[model samples]
Target: HTPGYGSAAKYIGSITKEVIRDGLVYDQQNVTLLEIMGRNAGWLTGAAALAKCEDCEGPDMIFLPEIPFDVENFMKKVEELHKRKKSVVVAISEGVKMADGRYVCELTGTIDYVDAFGHRQLTGTARYLAEKISREVGCKTRAIEFNSLQRCASHIVSRVDITEAFQVGGAAVKAAFEGETGKMIILKRVSDDPYICVTDIYDVHKVANVEKKVPREWINEAGDYVTEEFVSYIKPLIQAELTPIMVDGLPRHLYYTDVEQKQSR
Candidate 1:
């Protein structure tokens, strides 16, 4: 889990192209963006960079917590990009720390610890950055936190991701029935769109908090975004695939299983 913003900026650049083609590029080269996610691990943020890399007018400068933040250095980088492109997008992780070893997000709220995984709960880091940039850079800035929406967002689950999640759960059940205890099934995506996945068994303890991070090789350093290699790697996960079911403008939840045992009265 090497820390850096290069990966995130690249992924976000990829997905942004779709929106740009749809006329979502209001700022294009002028708009600046801040992405908030990842304090210890930037997996999600890396994915965003990959998304941005796919866009024609992707982000210009990205900031991640991996590198201890220096306000002067950041301002200098942003100013450089702005001068080069007129409009710029800067992605910053909410957990970015300062020279004094404090997170910029602290101004919004007190950093609280949640015992769930020793990860600091966060808020308003993007807004804080946006305000600072607006005042200093004198450019309109937008801050977007992917939020829980990106997780339960069944819509965005790469066809690959959803299928793999399902297969892993199903495999875990099957393995349990086979007396394979203390193990979990995992889905490994081999490709995108058409959707190819490989399911394997892994020890639950072996994967807990063993974060897989974005590879720097997938980032285009010169372009300040991700490359097609990363896009191809993740494209399958976001396939528009869904489970077949009847819809009535509401949830189609069913309460019972198809098979049942006979009643013994």
Candidate 2:
């Protein structure tokens, strides 16, 4: 499972506190801005909405790729909020596209790169919007991308996610050991009360390269946010604290030091 969902929520909370700490007053006129990860799936963006709700008890604005994006409509929404509120925090997903069916970032005509898996590399959709909005709205606009940093973070791993990951990995090993060939591990949620998950192996061909997306019901009708029900379903998974190793009164992280050098013959 991609940890991007939990990471998205964590960064949204971080940004909210950062804005408040930086004295970005929230009345009815200003907006706090952020960008999160997602390609075709809005899972990360939806998690950001959940994070925002958990951090602040006010209405927020979010933009996602699930709905056809309209820049003018977006600006209009911001303007409407600015008229009544001193501060507005808008969360946008990186893959968001315009009504004209173009990405604001695509104007750079940037040469795209792909990983071994052949997924297109993405960068800087937030910077484009922030620049555009700053020029058009005449407001202090700050765009922040919680990009790869989300995936790199282990400190914020959802206990549920970590546990699930470990279990899945173990399940994979067990499946292989049992002579169950060509299978991948999957999790089935049995109940929410105890937050139970059952790990089972699935045919590898059935799930490889297939993407599961956040359902429309999981998102608010405005296409910008997630519902409380969605949050409830996700919240327990992220619960439980991870213990950190301390060194000089700060958490310590370990890195590999042993390395083998190739000898030139």
Candidate 3:
């Protein structure tokens, strides 16, 4: 797993719990669609399952890009859930594709901008799906996109992730100082019980542009949720929180200002 993934997963998991609670406040039938960031991998979307616990049932369903999405089946599931309960929460990766290999969001015809890397700027996925559910399932719907918040939620960052990030950076610098080239620093998990990890340098050629997807067994047989093993693997990463130093009701940050630079000069 990448350094930032742990932090992102932490945020995603916490938010999922909060959303699940909020969804239950109303007595009417409602469906909430949470669109998480993931282009080809569903690691972040899978994190939503971490919200499951005794108090909360978590998301009723989770869809990942690793599996082809069936819109009809998804609708049927939501309708069935509505019959049993008032609120239905579903987490879906923004990159979920149909059997025809087209992104589910593409069906909305709202994606026109493409990045330089030939990747479509994926957004409005939750909105599109929420609208569909509201229309077809006839339930009140909400579309929530975690968006850039997932990446910049430093206030809720995991302490382990931050420490590992610094360690990985230091490892890279140490490697460069030792005349190493064309290599990348990667974290190797030494153990899971105590959650120990160490940084090691690997050939960049072999590591770069490689996508490590969530294992098939990590997902349930129905492909609507993640398994216990997946939860166990991620729980350790999001264990400890690094509370930000707050000043005047806001988190204080360290930075070099122009005045400081001029004074030094």
Instruction: Give candidate 1's TM-score.
Output: 0.70
Question: Alpha-carbon error at 226 in model 2, in Å?
Answer: 1.8
lDDT string for model 1 (1-265, tens) is 1111223333344444443343344644344455556674444554554544332554455555655667767777777776776556566666777778888778767677676777677767777777777788787666667555444434233444444566667877889889997776766555555556677788989987876645666656642445667656654444454553548765465455545433331
| Residue range 1-265, candidate 3, lDDT tens digits | 7899899999999999999999889988899999999887999999999889887888999998888899888888888998999888999999999899999989889899988767898888789888988888787999999999999999999988999999999999999999999999999999998788999998999976677888999989888888899889998788788989999999998889999999999
Candidate 3: stretches off by over 4 Å: 259-265
Give each prediction's root-mean-square deviation over alpha carbons. 5.8, 4.0, 1.5
TM-score of each: 0.70, 0.84, 0.95
Clashing residue pairs in candidate 3, if any?
none
lDDT of 1 at 119: 68
Candidate 1, residue 108: CA error in Å?
4.5
Best by lDDT: 3
lDDT of 2 at 101: 73
Winner on lDDT (2 vs 3): 3
lDDT of 2 by residue, 155-214 (tens): 665666767777878888888889998777778888989888888877889888887777
Model 3, residue 160: distance off in Å is: 0.6
Ranking by TM-score: 3, 2, 1
Candidate 1's C-alpha lDDT?
A: 0.58
Specify the poorest-scoring 10-residue window by lDDT in model 3: 207-216
Error of 1 at 98 (Å): 4.4
- Ten consecutive residues with minimal summed lDDT in candidate 2? 256-265
